[model samples]
Target: MPSRGSATTAVSGLVALAIAVGVVAMLSIGVGSRFIPPDSVLSALFSPGGGFYDNVIWELRIPRTVAGLVIGAALGLSGAVMQGLTRNPIADPGILGVHAGAAFGVVVAIYVFGLLDFRAHVGFAFAGAALVSAAVWLVGSRGRDGATPVKLALAGAAISAFIGSATSLVLYADSTAFDEFRFWSVGSLAGAKADLLLAAAPFLAGGALLAFGVIRGLNALSMGADVARSLGQRVRLVRGAAALAVVLLSGTAVAAVGPIGFVGLTVPHVARALAGPDHRRVLPYSALLGPLVLLGADIVGRVVAIPSEVQVGAITAAVGAPVFIWFVRRRTVREL
Candidate 1:
């Protein structure tokens, strides 16, 4: 058990992160292509009467910031859960094929159903992510080891490759499909809206609950499956629930922002480093840390190009890849 001082420190860190998230969210709202003064931004927020700044704040920045908040939290928390479940320091949500599955689902929606509406893609994304994740678990858990880390990684890789190739094949011939898919595939919060948030709310909420529920199980499981079972942790059930949570979180994030990698892959490492191995602390820290990085990246994307903005996905990847490499190459990485 943590000492009183340690517990207070953890709570303090969380509160600080929460405050940072608020600050960055406000920055995201204020520092877009056309900068709105802070006073006007506040006025729009406190009271709105259908003015220019009101429209930008309400329609554009608010939804985008909200999307950043939710998606960042989901990716961060989901990544932490994945790492905990797999007992791998580098595990991420995409290792379960969720991202590839969601991407393929979007492609199918555009190619087969001819439904180009972004909202129309959500159900298919959920279906694809769920089915592929289920398949990964089944295939990976085959024979003796039963969902061992290597097996799950290999299975996810194989399935992701096959699905990615199939998606490319569909897009190769259809220029129209490619045109529609290109915008989404890049991953940006520019298109986020209130309706999209409403569509994703249930899944996000469900995944967060499930992730939090498995905290104790993850702590036990980290000691090894045999030890976890002896500790009365239902290893299979915990893994299944974790996988489902990852699917829901990753699926909704992909559906919302078109597969913004690194948030789910990289943020957890930082959280674990700061919060230590106890998942109770790690998960909440991740929930806060993920959004801070993402919203910061989003703000940077908006300003770097001025009139034209880079996609948030690209910015995160550009920033995250190097940071991840540095973490891995570190002499003393934090315990998983």
Candidate 2:
């Protein structure tokens, strides 16, 4: 455990991170497609009734910025929850197959039902995520001790692979569906609608609350399940809560941004380095830092490719893969 001073420093760092994100987000809003000044960006955001900049800031940039923030926070928080539940230093929410399941749901909707609307996609995605999560949980818990973290993770991985293959087979059958899914599959914040954002909020909120509730339990559990059980914590309950939280958070993020990889895997590791391994400290820091990392990547994607913007998902994966490799090389994981 880190000292109190370290905690204080971490909190300060998070505050700094949030402020930095705000500033960078504002800069990004102003820098894109017929650049506006920073002052104008502020003016537009603050006084919506002011000028032409208001239209650009309020209509275009706000949704993208807010979506980036929400998705980033969701990924980070989901990673934190997954790691705690599994007690796996390298666990990622996507590794549970929630995203793949959601993608499959969306693919089915698109190809089978011929639904193309974002509104319809949101519902299908959530349903798919929930079903996949439940399936993984059930399979993991089938044998005996009710969802050990390792079993749960393995179930998720297996189920995810199956769903991914199903999606691929569908795509191979229908070229039209393949083209459409190709765009949505890359994970972006470009065309997010107000209704879609509203649709995702409940899951994000519910998941966040669930995660917060288990922070103390997670900290205890980290000490070892036997020790945690000795401390009167219900290991199963804690793990269940964490799993449920991951599903909501990770599912919502996938629904919002179409399974942008690596944020969940990468952000928590960054949080742990900054805030240490304590759940109480790690969770909040991950929440803040997650947005910062995501927003930074989004900004990079926007500028790196000129008029043709890069997908946020591609950007994150590009940046995250190398960092993830480094993490794997350095960390000596003791799986629970």
Candidate 3:
């Protein structure tokens, strides 16, 4: 159990993070190609007078911003849950082959099936991700010790490599698919549509709720599988629930915004550092920090080049890779 002072501090940090998310969301709406003033952005959002900037805000920026928020939260929570379940500090949706699976599914839909529409690809992405996640789990759990953190990580890495190679081969063979998937592969919120975001809402919300429900189980698991089982935790059930949550959250996000990496890989560690080892606090902090990091990355992508924008995925990679290296080198990041 966390001390009262620690709990209070965590609560306070969450509140501060909530405010920061709000501010960054506003920036996401206001700071874009045209640079709408903050006052105008507010007016366009609240008043709804049907002006040009108002239309831009309502039609374009709002949807993207909302997508960013949802996707960020999903990735963050997914990362946190994955790390907890695998007992690996480095476990992430993208690292675990989920993103590669989603990407491959979308490519197959476009190349083989001729399904060009973004909305139509969502189901394929989810299916692919679910299958790959199951495969990773199966391989990881094969050993006598049963799905240790090191085994899970190694399994995920091998599977991800295989799927990635398959994805590349398919793309190399199909010009049309290559052209269509290149943009989506890089990942960005620029083309996010309101309908797509709306469609993804239920899955993201359900995943988040499911993740929160397993907080106690995750906390016990943190102490190790034997300890968790000894404490009356149903290890299989908890693992199943956590895996389902990861599939729902990670698959949907990949389907929506392509595979934005680093957010999942880095945000949970940041959350744990801030709020201590408690999953209850770590989950919420990750949710808040996820958007803060992603939206900030998105904003940077927008401003870095005046006419041409960098993809959010690229920005996250640039930022996250260094942090990942630092975490590995610091000797402070303990294996879960």
The numbered model that scores best in TM-score is 1
- Model 1 TM-score relative to the real fold: 0.95
* Candidate 3 structure quality by residue, lDDT tens digits, 1-336: 866337779899999999999999999999877799998998888888966698889988899898889899999999999999888787787655788788889888998899987777878887888789789889977866676677777888899899989999989998989998887788888878988888889999999999999999999999988999999998878987888899889988998888898899899988887778889898999999999999999999999997888999999999889987898788656567
RMSD of 2: 2.1
Candidate 1 has its poorest 10 consecutive residues by lDDT at 327-336
Clashes of each: 1, 0, 0
Tell me how far the alpha carbon of residue 143 in candidate 1 is from the true structure, in angstroms, after superposition: 3.2
Clash pairs (backbone) in predicted model 1: 141-147
* Candidate 3 lDDT for residue 86: 83
lDDT of the structure predicted as candidate 1: 0.88
Measured with C-alpha atoms, the lDDT of residue 35 in candidate 2 is: 73
Give TM-scores for every candidate, taking all chains together and pairing residue i with residue i: 0.95, 0.94, 0.93
Better of 1 and 2 by lDDT: 1
What value does the lDDT take at residue 270 in candidate 2? 75
In model 3, how many backbone clashes occur?
A: 0
Angstrom error at residue 306, model 3: 0.8
Tens-place lDDT per residue, model 2, 1-336, is 857437568778878877987886776687665678877887777766868778777777788888888888999999988988888877887767788888998898899899987567777887888898888988997776777777887898899999989999999999988988887788888887666788789889999999999998899988888888899999889888888999999898888788788888878887777667888888998898788888888888888878889988999999999988887687723343
Stretches of model 2 off by over 4 angstroms after superposition:
1-5, 328-336
